[model samples]
Target: MRTEEIVAKALEKIGNDRYLLSNLVFSRVKQLCAGAKPLVDMDLKHNKLSDIAMKEIAEGKISIDRIDEKNL
Candidate 1:
C-alpha cells in the first residue's frame, strides 16, 4: 500500500492506544520516504509531525512524539 494509506490505516487502529507502536510506525513512514527518489514527495503527513519529529520517521528511530504529518 502507499505510505499515506498505510499511515491512515494505522491511525484507524490507534484509537486511544497511542504509544510505542505509533512512534515506530511514524518513524517507518519517514524512513521509507527518505529512501524515496524525491524525498520531499514521499512524506506520510499524518497527525502533525514537525521537522525534528520527522527525523524518527526518516531514520526509523523510536520517538516520543504522538503526531504524524500529512499532505492530504
Candidate 2:
C-alpha cells in the first residue's frame, strides 16, 4: 500500500487523533532506532523505520493500549 493509505488507516485505527498518531509513530520509531523489532512483517532494508511504525499501527499490531501497557 501507499504511504498515504497507510497513514489514513493508522489514523482510523486511532480514531483519527492526529496528535496520538504522531506520538505513537514517534515512540515506535525511537524504539526501532534503538533496535526494537518491528511488530509488522516488511522489508526492513527498504522501508524506513517511520513507515514500519505506521504500518504496525495501520494493521492494528500497535495500539494506544499496547503502548500504555508496554510504556513504549
Candidate 3:
C-alpha cells in the first residue's frame, strides 16, 4: 500500500491509538523476519519490514486480536 493509503487505514482502524498500532506493527515485522509471507502485494525489493507490515494493516490483512494490549 502507498503511504497515504496506509495512513488512512491506520486512522480508520486504529484511530489515535499509537501504542496499539505500534504493537501491531512490531508483531507483524517480527513475523515477517521469521519468514512469514507479506499479506499485501508490495514490491519487496524496496520495502522494509515496517512498510510491508503497514501495508498489511492497511489492507486488513492482519489484526491486533492476538495482542494483549493491557499487558503493554
Best by lDDT: 2
* Clash list (residue pairs), candidate 2: none
lDDT of 2 by residue, 1-72 (tens): 999999999999999999999999998888788888988887779999999999999999999888777676
lDDT tens digits, residue span 1-72, model 3: 368778678757866587878888888888777777787887667899999888777777777864343232
- Tell me the lDDT of model 2 at 11: 99
Number of clashes found in candidate 3: 0
Model 2 worst lDDT run, 10 consecutive residues: 63-72
Under the 3 Å rule for N, CA and C atoms, how many clashes does model 1 have?
A: 10
lDDT of 1 by residue, 1-72 (tens): 455654444444544344744565556456455642223333445433433234333433333343343321
Structural similarity to truth (TM-score) of each candidate: 0.27, 0.89, 0.77
Steric clash count of candidate 2: 0
What local distance difference test score does each model get? Answer: 0.43, 0.91, 0.75
Highest-TM-score candidate? 2
Whose TM-score is higher: candidate 1's or candidate 3's? 3
**lDDT score, candidate 1:** 0.43
- Looking at candidate 3, the ten consecutive residues that score lowest on lDDT are 63-72
